[model samples]
Target: MTEIRLITFDLDNTLWDVGEVLHHAEQQMRQWLDANVPEYTRTLDRDALTKIRTAVVTERPQLGHNVSALRQEVLFRGIVSCGYPATEARRYARSAFATFFQARQEVVFFEHALEALGELAASYQLGALTNGNADIQRVGLDRFFSFAFSSADVAASKPAPDIFHAALNHAGVAPQQCIHVGDNLIDDVHGAGSVGMHTIWVKLSDQPNTIGHTQPSEVVEDLAELPGAVSRIHTA
Candidate 1:
């Protein structure tokens, strides 16, 4: 194996608890809607909101990469469904999404994630490649990463080779000289492995081992163990 030159990462579960952050962000968005778009809030229930989001995604499949646009579109259509005019719905949608986006950036890093990033960044080029729309800079994590890419920017989500290839291009390294770290077995492990990159599976959930051509080269329970694990892989 080539010496690891660039270490790419998946943002959501690798560095922070995204599920909890999103829950709080959604709550904040709901509160803002109740205060500003009372009529829309009153008209749409939780189930109705899911239906509207589903409809939005179904109608606009291109949003598969851009989660922010997908959410804003859902807000706009939900407002329209509440009988608001297009212009009014557009205004409310922007405001509501702004509320959500702001709350979304208030992230809490996982145990040892920051220190691990600092140590890793000192030795290797670090890049963030994520399917979600989380802004590394906005969340105060930009200092650790040399570069960042999102599904929105590249118009291609992971599990596809395009995003990884984009990272390779920017870093000017061969796939063999890169390793991708993330929580998801498929998106991070299988995806990077398929492109001939080393893989580290952050086992945060009860996901089964991938049963295919790609598999993790290493697995660690937390970020604290990552540096050592990465060293082992690179030296092997």
Candidate 2:
């Protein structure tokens, strides 16, 4: 295999606990809504809000909308469904949803992310490619990545070759010279492998060995193990 010179990462589940982040964000949204929209305080709870948001997203999948837009829409629609006027619904939606989405910047990184990123950035070109709008700048990980590409920016999500190719192009590296690390088997391992890039599966939880069914690659439980995994692949 060609010597690996570039390393691209998937942001959400790889370097951060997305579950924890989303959980906190949800709680924050609920508290904000309850305080501001007294009528909603009695009617809409977090679970109901979540279900309505899911329905909206499923119904409008082709809108290519971001989470922020969807959240606002869900809040407004939920208020209107509860017999609130359009003007009042829009007002509460803007205030409550902005508070929640902006607070997402407080999400914490994985324990090993800083040390691993520092070590690898010293030796190889580091980049990020994510299917979601995980603002690296807001997350304070922007300095570690040489380039960052998001599905929102590229109009193509993971499991698609276009997102990976965009990351390689931004990093000025060829497929054979880069290894893509992510938590999803199909999106990270299979997609990167399809383009001749090495793969690293960051097993955040006890995930099954799905990669075994596809092309063989390295696996690590945490970001700290990533440097060694890359070294082994290079020396193999």
Candidate 3:
């Protein structure tokens, strides 16, 4: 059996509950806007801002991968709509996005996430392949990865082959020699599988774990169970 040479990971939801983190980050941004630019607080409330973000991504599909730019653009647009001049809008957008970003990086990891990664990192070349803007360095997880590629890095997100291929080439490994661990069935499991890599699905819940009736190569309940699952897959 071929040994797994490189292991790539998904960030949000796989390592931490991203939904809660994002919600808190949004609240932080709202508070900042209320204190600094009070008009935006009234005009770009949560729901309104969500619609603006959706519209920005919808109109410029490529912005989906570049979350930082997408966010800045949304803030700029929102501020402009609320009667701010273009110059002040841009300035405020940069400052506001920075505030939200700091809060976003304050992630609370899942149980045993760091311990399991430490164990795996000893024997394998670890990498991160995420569609989010989460900075491994900021999150104190940079020590685990030899390389980390985000959608911003590759100009494309998961379920696409580009980011997967980037990680494979970075590690100088073939698809069969790599394994991708992620929580999403389609973007993580099927995405890596489509590129001919092995996959481990981090099934956090008992929800249906199939992509159009096709199951992942392996499934684990949490990061604590990941090391054993990877060991089994390496020799299978």
Candidate 4:
């Protein structure tokens, strides 16, 4: 294998507990809505919210790649459905999304995630490749990553080659010289492998490795083990 010159990461779950962050962010957004748009909050149910979101994605397929836009559009339609005029609905949508987006950046990093990235960044070019809307800059990880790409940036998400290819192009490295580290088996392992890049799977020790057929070059249960995994691949 070519020496690993660049290491790209999946932002959401690889470095932080995204599930907790998202749940909290959603709660924060709900509180904001309840305070500012009482009528919309009173009328909107889970089913109704899902319907609005679905309609937004279905009607405007391009928003599928842009989660932030998709979410704002959903909120706009939901508010308008509650009898707000288009201008007021648009303003409310932006404010609600701002609340959500701000809360979303309040992420708790996985144990030793920062230390691992700090160590690896010293020797290799580090980049972020994600399908989610999490901004590395807003997440306070911009110091470590030389570049970052999202589904919105490439108009395609992982499991497709667009994101991985964008990372390679941005880093100016061949696929063989890069390794992608992510928690998802298919998105991280199979996606990078398809483009001839190596992969390291960051599965928690307790999680079941159901997709064992999609192999990664390395596997680390903890972020502390990440640097060693990359080193082993580098020296191979």
Error of 3 at 205 (Å): 2.2
**How many Å off is the CA of 207 in candidate 2?**
1.3
**Candidate 4: TM-score?**
0.97
| Alpha-carbon runs more than 4 Å astray in model 3 | 211-214
Question: Arrange candidates by lDDT, highest first: which order?
Answer: 4, 3, 1, 2
The runs of at least 3 residues in candidate 2 whose Cα sits more than 4 Å from the true structure, single-residue gaps closed, are: 45-51, 63-65
RMSD of 3: 1.5
Lowest-sum lDDT 10-residue window in model 1: 204-213
lDDT per model vs. reference: 0.89, 0.81, 0.91, 0.91
Going through the candidates in order, what is the number of backbone clashes in each?
0, 0, 0, 0
Q: For candidate 2, list the clashing residue pairs, or say none.
A: none
TM-score of each: 0.95, 0.86, 0.95, 0.97
Candidate 1 on 91-157: residue-level lDDT in tens?
A: 9999999999999989999999999999999999999999997888899888989899887888888
Candidate 1 TM-score to native:
0.95
